[model samples]
Structure formats: structure tokens, C-alpha cells
Target: MKEKFLCWQTSGWGLSLLLVLPIVAIFYTAAGESDEVFSHLMGTVMATYTSNTFWLVVTTLVLALLFGLPAAWVMAMCRLPGEKVLQWALVLPLAMPGYIIGYIYTDWFDYAGPIQIFLRDFFGWHSVHDYWFPDIRSLGGASMVLALVLYPYIYLLARAAFLEQSTSLLQSARLLRCTPWESFRRVSLPLARPSIAVGLSLVAMETLGDFGTVSYFAVNTLTTAVYDTWLGYSNLNAAAKISAIMLVAIFLLISAERFSRRKQKLFQQELAHGDDVRYTLSGARKWLALIWCWGLVACAFLFPLMQLGYYAWHYFAESWTPEFRAYSFNSLQVSLTAAVLAVVLALIVNFYRRLDGRRMTLVPIRISSLGYAVPGTVLAIGVMIPLTQADHLLNDLAKSLELSPPGLVFSGTMVAIIFAFVVRFSAVAIGSIESSLAKVSPSLDMAAKTMGYASTRMLRRVHLPLIRRGCLIAGLLVFIESMKELNAALLLRPFNFETLATYVFNFASDEQLELAALPAILLVLVGLVPLVMVNRSLEKKH
Candidate 1:
């Protein structure tokens, strides 16, 4: 028994160490002194990068809260017309990538775009001096684009927290003659703080990880700096250093979120009725609420979707080429491959924890899952460092053997891209599988063991059958994330390789968003599958 346990523990630890190698490589490479590049960056553009990153995080968080909180609270606590439809519709924007949003809105709102052109024509003011028009490429504009997509994170968590709260507390507040607003402020808001913090932390991490959106907007963030340093200037050391800096910021944000939740405790009434006391809006208030929720849906999802649809229809003949088919195939192939591997690895780690339930097993799972929190850009940098070294070693070996050197066979290939995707998205699989596994009764494991079945056999015959849904969910979630991923794909893809994300990003970077519309819209549609599944699951639970 002890030997079998040790073997399981070893497997878990081994996988964890493998997953964590990229992060370790990052810190190791970043420790080297690169005074020339580091000093130059610090003197020239480092401050701008750092400040833009900070303010973008701040601005996006604030806007997401402003947009998501009220909507969540209204849906959870109030009775409004079309509430059911609006509830799920609001989450649709989550399917839109921040970069795609940036691309679409920038084209629509740019100085030479249709909106400004129409305004100029109507007012007979063609010159720049005639009026003040906000640049969609500014930092503020970038934040709004990010916020529109990211607010769903806050809404999902905050709404769940609100719905789960016991009605007794609200009743007590009402007994004290408290109004709905006062009750929410005094009781509900405080209880939901931890959940909101979690959502905010996720939003902050995503904002930090963003590359394409900020890049298209000409915003100099740490992620972009990391990319430019490594690829543009051919400075791996400096890029690693910038990636390390971003990693530190992410760690801080995660720590703050965990700290906020440390003392959170919720008490539920054991036999409480299913009835929830909700406030009803009427007259102008009803219209205002309806407009507020619908407007968010329209702006975030419907409008952009319509724009994409129009462009895709108009450009279909030109855009639907063999190359586009290749891009789609590459995306599906890589995403499916990554999703399967991630789920299998997650099952291994999680199964080990189920058998042993030891700190050794748990710690490894936790550490391995940390890659999800690391930005894709940082992960790509970390992954490239090790792969590049391996390539050099391979070339050296080939030279000694009097053979042709394989130049960049590993680093300049799809292997590194898939590895980065697995590292970044394994957590999604782990979390989903973990949740499903937690629901399975321990008696099933015990029963299988009593029948002389080993742990491996038990998992194969017992847990596997029960957790099929979880495995599917995990794969789907990971696939969607991998499909939409831009930063790592942009950094690590082989020469002449083009996934759907990279394809759209390339065209958008060149200010040719119309040419990229079909793929971008397809990406959005693909992303919606998981979102819809999640919404249905949430509805069933509520």
C-alpha cells in the first residue's frame, strides 16, 4: 500500500514539476544582469509600460464593476421585464475577444471611419479643428473595450453570490425599516465582497495578459514590451525580465484576492423556502432598468455581432479561401489537442489527490495550476527560453556527430505553442474535473477497492464513467480558451503558421479588420458554445 501510494505521489509531483518548468525558467533567465537593455528600457519606456498596465487594470476593473454589478444586482434582487432573457444575454459578450472588440470599435469610431465621416458630412466640418473626437486607440478606449467583454466575470460571480444569500438577512434588515438600497448596502454588499474580489482579480489578470487589444490600440503595456524585446530587439534576457515583472504584478493581485476571501463565511438556513423576496421596478424606473440592461447587451454583443455579420457577408467570397480553411483547421487541431492533453493531465493529478488526500499531492496540483494565472505572453517567453536552449544543445550534438543541424526544430515549431496552451489552460480542466470529482461519493471508491480493484482500475471503471460530463466540460472550456488565445500563439507559432486568432490579429494589426471579419466572427461563435453551456448550468443551479 505504501509503495503504491508513493508511486502515485511521484507521478503527481512529476507532472506538477513539468508544468511549473516554464515559470521556473522565466525567473531563472530573468535573474541575469542585462544592464544595457534593462537600463535603456528603464530610462526610456519602462515607466510608460508600467503605468499603462497599472491604469489599464484600474480603469477596466472600475468599468467592469460599474457595468456588471448593477446588472447583476438587479437581476438577482429585482423583478424586471424580460429579466430572464436579459440575464443570459448579458453574458454573451464574454464570447467576444478583447482584441476583436478593439478591432471592430476602432474601425467604427476612427477619424476616417464611418461614424466620424458621417458626423463631419452632416455638420459640414471636415477639418480636425472643427470638433473634438475621441480616439478609439487611446488607453481609455482600450479599457472600455476590455471592460465590455470582462464584465461578465464580475456579473457571474456577483450574481451567484447574491442568489445564494439567505433571505432571512434581508428580512431582518426590512424589519428594522431599512429600504432595499440600505439593506443591500448593509448586508448584501458586505457578504458579496469576497466573490466580487475574486471576479475583479480574474479581470485584472486578464487585462494584464491582454496583448492584441492593447497592441492594436498602441498602448505600451508590459506584455507588449515583453514581445517587442524578444522579437523586435532580439533580447531574450530583457524580455524575460519584463515577463518577470508582469508575473510579480499578477502574483500580487492574486494574493490580494485570496487575502480578501480569507475570512469569508456564509450561513444558510437549513429548511428555508424556495421563495426569494425581490423588489419590483415600475414606471420610469422599469424603463430605465430595461434600457440599462438591454443597452449593455446591444453594445457588447448584438451591435458588434451585426457588424461582423455584415462584413463577413460582404467579404465572404474573398475571405473564404483555402488559406482561411487552413487557419481554421490549425486552430481546431491545436485547440482539440491541447484540450485533451490538459484534461488527461488534470485527471492524473486529481486522481492522485483522491487516492492519497495528502498535502504532497495537493501542493503539486496547486502549483501546477498556477500557470493559468500567468499571462500567456509571460508563459510564451518562459517556454521559449528552455526550448531555445534545447535547440542549441541539439545543434551542438548534431555538429559533433557530423550531421546537419536542426535549426529551431523545437522552438520554431507548433510543439512550443501547444505546450504554452496546455500550461495556460490546464487549470480550467483541473477546476472543472475537481468540482465534478468532489461530487462523487467516496463510497464508490471504497466499494471498488473492497472488490479487490486497484486505484487505477477503480478510476478507470468507476470515476471515469461518472465524470464523463466533467471531462467533456473541461475539454470544451479549454478548447474555447485555446481557440481565442492570441498572445502565446502570436509569440510562439512557427514561420508561416496561422491559427484563426493569429490570422485575425495580423489583419487587425495592419488596419484591415474587414478582411479578418469572417474568422473573427467564427471565433466568437465558437466561444459562445461554452458560454451557453455555462449559462444553462447556472440556470439549473439557480
Candidate 2:
């Protein structure tokens, strides 16, 4: 039994180390000679890239807060018709990729698009010199696109924080002659700070890692710099250096968030019926809340989705092709494969933790999940370094053996892409499985063991059945994330291979979002599956 347990622990630690290797490889690769390249970049584009990355993080966080905070409060503390629908509706925008939103808005607001055309005719302005319009292809536009898709992170966290607030304290605030505004400012906001801060960190992590939207807008950030350094300039060491810098930034961002909340602890009771104490708003207040909440939903999810649908409909003939079908199939194949592998890994690590409750057993779980903190572009660079080395090693061995050299079998094939996807998305599966496994009481394990059930038998009869739903959810989440993944796919994909994400990005990059609309809409619809399932599951739990 001890041998079996040791084996399980070894497997967990080994798998976790496998995932961590790529990240370590980034530094190893960056450690190669690159002083000249570094100096060149410092003399040229590095400062601009650093500045854009910094401000993009700040601007996106600010915008997401502006959109998310109000919506979270209204949902948590107000009464309105269709409240349930609106609550979930706010999260629907998460299914829309930032690049898709950037494309849609840019198309509409461009010089030749309908919005500018209408503006030109309405004011009788003939040309660009006659009017001023903010470019949707700028840093500000990329931030807005990112905020629309990402604010839901804040919304979900802030809403949960609000829902769990102490109702008694709120009532006490009311009795102390506090207005609703004052009560919210004094009590709710402070209480929700921890959750909001965590959410904002996630947003910042994503903004820092974002490639498609920022790249599409011609806005250079650390992410784009990594991609361009590798591909455009063909400088792998410089790309690794950039990736190392980004990783440092992400680490600092996370550490700062943790530091901020270290001294703060809340012992408030969870209010199961938090909604019972919700303020009843009627007349103007009700209208204002409704507009504020649903208007965001309209702008974020509905409007962009409708625009996509319209474009998809009109361009169906052009967009829907055998090539499109092939890429869609590629997406499904890769996503399904990656999803299954990620879930298997999640189950392995999570099951080991379940069986061995030692504090050190948590190391694997923590290590396995670290991949999620890495951005896709950086991850791709990290993934490439080792795989490329392995490919070269294989080729050399084959040559020495007088065998046919299979070139780039590991690095320049679907293998590389799938590995990166699994590394990038395994965290989603691990979180879902870990959360689900925690719900199964330890007593059940003891009971099964006493009944003479062996470890495998116990997992089969007791754990697996109970956690099957979580496994499914984890798989679905991984699948949806894999389907939407653009950065790793963009960087790691083979010469002619394309997933739906890469396909849409390629077409959109050519200023032909019209031709990409079908795949873009397909991507959105696929992404909605996990969101809808998650919401339904949360509803059941609530």
C-alpha cells in the first residue's frame, strides 16, 4: 500500500514537473547570448512595447472596473424583472474574444464603414480632414475590446463577494442614517476589495498576455514583441528574453495582490438569502439600473454578436469553404485531444492530493496550475525551445544511425501545438476537478477503505462516480478554452495548419473580417457552451 502511494505521489510530481519544464526552458533559452539583440531592442522598440503593455494593463483594469463594479452591485443589491436572465447575460460577453470585438468595432467605425459614412453625410463632412473620429485600431480601442470581454472576471468575483456579504451589517449601516450610496461605499466596496483585487489581477494577467487584439490593432505590447521577436525578426533568444520579462511582471502583479490582502481578514457570515434584503427600486431608479445593467450586456455581447451574425450571413458564401471546414475540424480535433489529456492530468494530480492529505502533496497541484498564469505567447516561446532541441536531437540521432531524418517531428507539427494547449489550459481542468473533489467528504474514503476497497477500487467505486460531473465540466472548460486559444495556436501551429481561432485571425489581419465572420461566430458559439453550463451548475448550487 505504501509502495502504491509512493507511486501515485511520484506520478503527480512527475506530471507537474513536465508542465513546468517549458517555463523553465524560457529562461534557459533567454540565457543564451543576446546582448546585441537586447541593446538593439532597447535602442528601438523595447521602450514602446513596455509602455504599451503597462498602460494597456492599467487602462483595461480601469475600464473593466467601471463596467463590472456597477453591474455587480446592481445584480447583488437591486430588484428587477428578468434579474436571473440579466445576471447570467452579463457573463455571456466572456464568450466573445477580444479580437473579434476589436474587428467588429473597427469595421463599423473605420473611414469607409457605415458609422463614419453616416457621420460624414449627416454633418456634410466630405473627408477625414472635415471630422475627427477616434481610431478603433489604436491602443484605446484594444483596451475597450479587452475590457468588454474581461470585465466578467470582475463581475463574477465581485458578485460572489456581494452575495456573501453580512446582511446584518448592511442593515446596521442603514439604521445609522447611511444612504444607499454611503452604505455601499463604506461597507460593500471595502468588503469586496479582496475579490475585486483578485479579479483585477486576472484581468491584468490577461491584458499583459493578450496578443490577437493588441496585435490586430497594431499596438505593440510585450506579447506582440515576443511574437514578433521570434517570427518577424527570427530571433528566438530575444523572444525568450522578452518572455522572461513578461513572466517577471506577472509574478510581481500576483505578489502585489497577495501582499495587499495579507493583513485583511473577513469573518463575515455568508447570507444564503442575500437577495431577500435587496433594495426594491421603482420608477427612475429601476429604469436607471435596468439600462445600466442591460445596456452593458447589449454593448458587450449582443451588439457584437449581432454584427457578427449579420456579417456571417452576408458573407456566408465567401467565408464557408472547404478550407474553413478543414480548420474547424482541426479545432475540434485538437481541442478534444487537449481537453481529454488535461482532464486526465487533473484527475491524476487531484486524486493524489485526495488520497494523500499531506501539505507537501499540495506542491504538485500548485505547480500544475502555474501554467495558467503564463500568457500564450510566452508559453508558445517556452514550448518551442525544448521541442526544437528535442527535434534537433532526434534528427542527429537518426543521421548517426543512417536512418531517414524526420525533420521537426516534435516542434513543427500538431504535436507542438497540442502540447502547448494542454500546458496552457490544464489549470482550468485542475481547478474544476480540485473543487469538485473537495466536495467529496474524507469520511467516504475511510469508509471505503474499511470496507476493503483498494485504492484503485475505491477511486472507481467512490470518487470517480461522485466527481464524474466535475470531470465533464473540466473537460468542457478546457475544450472551450482550447477552441478560443489564439496566441499559442498562432505561434506554435505548423506551416499550413489552422484552427478556427488562427483562421479567423489570419482573415481579420488582412482587413477581411467579412470573410472571417463565419468562423468568428462559430468560435463564439462554441465558447458559449462552457459559460452556459457553468452558469446552470452555479444556479443549481445556489
Candidate 3:
């Protein structure tokens, strides 16, 4: 038993170390350089990148909350026709890659596209200067595009929080003559704080990590700077320096959020028997609700998909290639592998947390969760710098042993792509697993142990059965997340290796919207299944 305990503890620490080492490697690489890189960055692009990234984060956060929180409230508090379908449909956008959406919107809203063309012809406007239309490739456009795809994270969590509120607290507020709005604001919102934080953190992290959409729009954020420094100028040190700055900003934001939430107590008990208190909408209000739901669906799902499908039909028959098929296969293999690995690791991590009952594991768990906080390019750079060094050492050992050097295992290969995906998407699995594990009782483990069963046997026999549903949900979410991952895959894919995301991103960078359509549509289609499943879980839980 002592031996088993040590093994579990060490395994937990080792995995945690694996998670942090790459990030540490990134910091070390940046810090090892002299003050010259910092001064250069400061003189030219540093301030601009910092301002743009900060504003983008703030704008995306606010917009997502505006769009997401009310939608969550409506879904949780009201009964309407096809409400469940609408709820799920709202989340379907979660699967749409920001790059794809950015591409679709850029075309639709561009001067030559249908919307602007129609307006131009109708109004007799000839030049972009004649109309006061906003550019879809600006920072504002990136924020809106990001929020449209990411609001679902907020919606899902807020809905969960709204549904899980204690009926007694709500009742007490009602007894004190509080309105539903007041009760929600004063009582339920406070209880829902943790879920809200989780949701907002996801949105901000994703915004920071974004590469495709921002790059397409020519937004000069750190993600773009990372690419520019590495690929354009051939300066890995400068790229590493930019990534380090982004990481610092991410750490600061995370710390501030943590400090803000530190004073709030998150514990709350659900009523043993309580159903959602549904409000009936009146005639005009009913139509308003319908319009609002459909409007969000149009912007979030319908417009971009229709645009992509239209282009696909217009171009695919003429331009389909064998390369597309191969890239699709590559995407499937990598995404599915990463998804499975993330879910499995999540299961182990959760189990370890339960077994050890120590606060030490929490540090690594939080660090692992921080992957979602950093940009994909930044994280990819972090992963790449250290992995390359490790790869070199391994190759040296292999040469000494007279074995073949492992040239592509850690860098420029499927393994690295999958590792980055696991780092980026595991947070999704962790959330699902924690929720699933919460439904399981500890008494079963104790009872099994008391019956002379080993701890492993107790876990296998007792905990696994209860947590299976969570695992399924977690795996599905990770699969969906991997399907949509873009920046990490783009930067880290091996030579001659391509994924669907890389295929679309290549064309998007060149402004070849027509060529990018088919793969983007397919990516969105693949993402819909998990999105629907997550929505179903939310509704059923409510």
C-alpha cells in the first residue's frame, strides 16, 4: 500500500512537471537572451501589440457576456417552443473555427461581396470611402468574430449555474419582495460566480490564443508577432521574447481574476426537489424572444455556414484536390488521438486528486488549466523550444547507443501537434470530469475499501462506473476542440504534413476565400455533433 501511494504521488508530480516544463522552457529561452531583444521589441511593435491584445481581450469579454449571459438567463428561466433546440443551436457556433468565421465574414462584408455590393449598387456608392461601413479585418471585427464563436462557453456555464441555484435562496429573496431580476442579481449571480469565472477565463484565453482570425484580419497581436518574428524575419529569439511578454500579460490577468474571486465563497447546495421556474412570455414578448434567438443563430451559425457552403458548391466541383483528402485524414487522426489522450489523462488526474486528497496536486492542475489561458502560438512556441532541446539530447543518446536518432518525435511531427492539442483542449475534459465526479458519492469508495478491496479495485469497480458518462462527454468535447484548433497545428505540423485547419489557414492567409471554403465547412460540420451533445447535457441537467 505504501509502495502504491508513492507511485501515485510520483506519477501525479511527474505528469504535472511535464505540463509545466514546456512553459518553463519558453520563459527560460526568452529570459536567457540579453536586453537587446526587449529594447528592439519596445521600440517598434511592443506597445502596439500590447494595446491591441489588451483591447481585444476586454472587448471580446464584454461582448461575449452581453450576448451570452442574457441568452443563458432566457434559456434557464423561460419556456418557449423549441427552446431546447435553440439552446443547443446557440452552442453550435462553438465548433466553428474563428478563422473560418473571420474568412466568411470578411468576404460577406467586404466591398466586393454580396452585402456591400448590394448596398453599393442600391445606394450608387462606388468606393469604400463613400460608405461608412466598418472593415471586417480590423481589431473590432476580430473581437466580434471571436465573441460569436466563444459566447457559447459563457452561455453553457452560465446556464449550468442558473440551473443549479438553490431554490431556498431564491425563495427567501422572493419572500423579501425581491423581483426575479433583483434575486438573480443579488443571490443567484453571486452563487454562479465560479462558473462565470470559468467561462470568462475560457473566452479570454481563446481570444489571446487566436491566430487565424486575427491574422486574416491583419490584426497585429502577439500571435501575429510570434509568426512574423519567426517565419518572416527568421528571429526565433524575437518571437520567443514576444511570446514571453504575452505569457506575462496572461499571468497578470489570471492573477487579477483569482484575487478578485478569492473573497467570494462558491459553495452552494441544490434543492433536492425543484424544477426550473419557467416564465410565460406574452404576445409581443414571445415574438421578441423568438427574434432574439433566431438573430443570434443567424449571426453565429447560419451566415458563415451559408457563405462557406455557397463558396464550396461554387468552387469544389472545379477545384477539389487529392491534397484535400490527405489533409482531412491527417486532421482526423491527430484530433481523434489528442481527444482520446486528453480524456484519459483527465480521468487519471481527477482520480489522483481524489486519492491523494492533497493540495499539492492543485498547483499542477491549475498550471495545466493555464494552457487555455495562453495563445496557441505562444504555447506552441513554448512546447517547441524545450521539445527541440530534449529531442537533441535524445538524439545524442541514440547516437551514443548506436541507434537511429529520433528526428521527428518531438518537433515537426504529428506527436508535437497532438501534444499541443492535449495541452490546449484538456481543460474541456477536466471540467466535464469534475462535474461527472461530483455526482459520484465517496461512500462507495469507502465501502469497497472496507470490504478488503484494493484502492485500484475500488476505483475500477466503483468510481469508473459512475464517472463513465463524464468521460464520454469530456472525450467528445476534446474531440470537438481539437477539430477546431488552428494556430498550434499550423505552426507545429511536420514538413509535408497537413490538417484541415492548416489547409484552410494557408488559403485564408492569401485571401483566397473561395479555396478555403470546403474544408472550413467540413470542420464546422464535424464540430456540430459534440456541440449538440453538450447542449443536451446542459438542458437535461437543468
Candidate 4:
């Protein structure tokens, strides 16, 4: 029994370390000296990069809160017309990537695009000098584009917090003759603060990590700096340093969020029962709430989807070519591979935790799960640094053996990208599997043990079957995320290799988004599967 326990513990630690290896590689590489490139960046572009990234995170957080808080409040606590449809519809935007939305909106709002053309013809304006317009490729525009998609994170978590709040607290406030708005402001908002902070932290990390959206808008954020430093100037050391800087920022945000959550727990109120009294809107208030909810859904999900469908319909033949097939195949191949690997890794760590139930065993799960908070750009930089060195070592070894040098085996192949994907998304799988495994009764484990089953056989016979649904959900979530991922994919894709994300990014970068509309739409459609599943799960829980 002791030997088996030792084996399981070692396996869990090994797997957890493997998942975190890329992140370790990044910081290790960054610790090395890079005086020349670092000095040049500091003197030239670092300030602008830091400033833009700061404003982007701040602006996106504010906008997402503005859009999400009221919407979440209305949907969770108020009875408005079409509330059911609006509730799920609001979540649809979470399925769309920020970069895809940025590209689509830029095309629509550009000076020569349909909106401007119609305005010009209608108002008899001839050219740019005849009217004033906001540039779609600016920092402010990028923030709004990201907010439109990312607000769903805030909505989901904030709404869940609202729903989980004690009804008696709100009723007591009402009994004190407080207005509905006042009750929410004084009661609901405080309780939901930690959840909102978590959502905002996620938005901030995602914005900081964003490459395609910021790149499309010509915003010189740190993520773009990392890419340009590595690929444009061929300076891996500089890129790693920039990535490390971003990682520090992300860690600070995560720590702040965790602290906020701890405070929330300290002050949290327990509900006596699962009962919530929802307010019903009437007169002008009703219509206002209806418009607010539906308008968000329209702007976030429906509008872009309609545009993609229109473009795909007209350009299907041109867009759906052999290259498109290759891109689709590559996306599925990588996404499925990453999904399976992540699920397996998650199962290993979680199973070990189940068997041990020790504080030390839980540490590996926490450390491994931290990859989700690390930006994809940082993860890619981390992955590439070590793999590149390993490839160089292998080539040198082959040369010493007097054999034809095997070139670029790890870094130049799909291995690095897939490894990055697994590291970045293993958290999603771990969360899902852990939650599911927690629901399994300990009695089942005891029963298996009484029947003389070993730990491995017990897991295979009991936990595996019980958590199959969770495993599927985990796989689907990781699969969808892998499909929409852009930063890591953009940075790590080999020469002439393109996933659907990179394909759409390339076309959108060249202002040829119409040519890539089919793939973009397909990506959105694929993303819907997990969103629907999540909605169903949430509904079941509610």
C-alpha cells in the first residue's frame, strides 16, 4: 500500500511539473542577461507598450462592467419581457473571439466600408474632409471590441453570485423602504464584488495577452512587442523578457482577485433556502430593461454573425478551397489532440488528489492550474525558448555523430504549439474534472476498497464512469478554446502552417476579412457547442 501510494504521488507531481514546464522555461530564460535589446526597448518602445496595455485593460474592464453588470442584474433579479431568451442570448458573445469581432467591426466601420458609404451618399458628403469619423483601428475601438465579447464573463459570474445571494437580506432592505436600485447597490453589488473582480481579472489577463486584436488595430501593447521582438527582430531574449513582464502583471492581477475572493468569503452571508424574489418591471422601465438586454445581445453576437453569414454566402467558393480544408484539418487535429491530453493530465492530478486528500497533493493542482492565468503569448514564448534550445542541442549532437543534422525537430514542428495549448488550457479541464469528482460520494470508494480493489481499479470502475460527463465537458471546453486561440497560435505556428485562427487573422490583417468569412463563421459555430452546454449546466444548477 505504501509503495502504491508513493507511485501515485510521484506520478501526480511529475504530471503537474510537466504542465508547468513551459512557464518555468519562460522565467528561466528571462532571468538571463539581455542588456542590449532590453536597453533599446526601454529607450525606444517600452513606455508606449506599457501605457497602451494599461489603458486597454482599464478601458475594457470599465466597458465590460458597464455592459455586463446591469445586464446581469436585470436578467438575474428582474422579470422583463423575453427574459429567458435574453438570459441565454447574452452568453452567446462569449463564444466569439475578440480578434474576430475586431476585424469584422473594423471592416464595417472603416471610411470606405458600407456604413460610411451609406452615410456619405445620404448626407451628400464627398470625402474624408466632408465629415468627421472615429478611426476603427484605434486603442479605444479595440477596447470596445474586446468588451463586447468579454462582458459575458462578467455577466455569467456576477449573475451566478446574484442568484446565489440570500433572499432575506434583500427583503429586509425592502422592508426598510429602500428602492430596488438602492437595495441592489447596497446589498447585491457588495456580495457580488468578488465574482465581478474575478471576471475583470480574466478580462485584464486576456487583454494583456491579446495579439491579433491589438495587432490588427496597430496598438503597440506588450504582447505585440513580444511577437515583434522575437520574429521581427529575431531576439528571443528580448521577447522572453517582455513575456516575463506581462506574466508579472498577470500574477499581480490574479493575486488581487484571490485576495478579493477571500474577503468576500469572510463577509459572505449564507442563504436559509434556495428562494429568490425577482422584481418585475413595468411601464417605461420594462421597455428600457428589455432594450438594454436585447441590444447587448444584438451588438455582441447577432450583428457579427449576420455579417459573417452574408459574406460567407457570397464568398463560399473562393474561401472554401484546398487551403481552407488544410486549415480546418490542422485546427481539428491540434484542438482534439490538446483536448485529450489536457483531460488525461487533469484526471491524473485530480485522481491523485482524491486518493491522498492532503494539502501537499493539492499544491500540484493549484500550480498546474495557474497556466490558465498566464497569457497565451507568454506561454508561447515560454514554450519556444526551451524547445528551440533543445532542437539546437539535438542538431549539434547529430553533427557530432557525423549524421545528417536533424533540424528543428521540436520548435519547428507542431509539438511546441500543441504543448503550449495543453499548458494554457489544462486548467479548464482540471476545473471541470475536479468539480465533477468532488460530487462523487466517498462511499463508492470505500465500497470498492472493501471489495479488495486497488486504487487504479477503483478509479477505473467508479470515478471514471461517474465523471464521464465531466470529461466530455472538459474536452469540449478545451477544444473550443483551442479553436479560438490566436496569440499562441500566431506566435508558434510553423512556416506555411495555419490554423483557422491564423487563417482568419492573416486575411483580416490584410483587410481581406471577406475572404476568410467562411472559416470565421465556422469557428464561431464550433464555439457555440460548449456555450450551449454551459448554459444547460447553469440552468440545471439554478
Summarize candidate 1's per-residue lDDT along 395-443 as a digit string, tens digits: 9999999999989988998889989999999999999999999999999
- CA lDDT, every prediction? 0.91, 0.91, 0.81, 0.89
Worst 10 residues of 3 by lDDT: 269-278
Please, what is the TM-score per model?
Answer: 0.97, 0.97, 0.88, 0.96
Q: How many clashes in candidate 2?
A: 0
Candidate 3 local lDDT, 1-542, one digit each (tens) = 55666766676567667766667877888887556655787798778998998999999999999888888878877788898678778888887888888877887888788999999899999998897988787999999999998999998898888877777777788789998678778977778778888899879888987888888888888888897777777666677888888788778777877887887765666644445555677698778888887788889889888888888899986548899888988988998898898887777677777777768766656666657666779878878887787788989999999999878567867878898888877788887887788788888777887898876787788888888888887887787778778888878889999888888989877888788889888888888887767566655654
Q: Please list the residue runs of candidate 4 whose C-alpha ends up more than 4 Å from where it truly belongs after superposition.
A: 266-276
State residue 453's C-alpha deviation in candidate 1, in Å: 2.2
The weakest ten consecutive residues by lDDT in model 4 span 264-273
Question: Model 2 over residues 1-542: C-alpha lDDT tens digits?
Answer: 55768878888999999899899999888888877777799899899999999999999999999999999998988889999999999999999999888888888888898999999889999889987899888889999889999999999899889888987988889899898799899999999999999999999999999998998888999998898888888888889999999999999999999999999999997666534778899999999999998998998889988888888899899887999999999999999999999999999999998888889989998888888999999999999999999999999999999999999998999999899989999999999999999999999998998999978789889999999999998999899899999999999999999999999998988989889989988899998997888678667755
Two-way TM-score contest, 3 vs 4, winner: 4
Please give the lDDT score at residue 291 for candidate 2: 95
Clashing pairs in 3: 209-375
Show model 1 residue runs off by greater than 4 Å. 269-273
lDDT of 4: 0.89
True-structure lDDT of candidate 2: 0.91
**Alpha carbon deviation, residue 52, candidate 1 (Å):** 1.1
Clashes of each: 0, 0, 1, 0
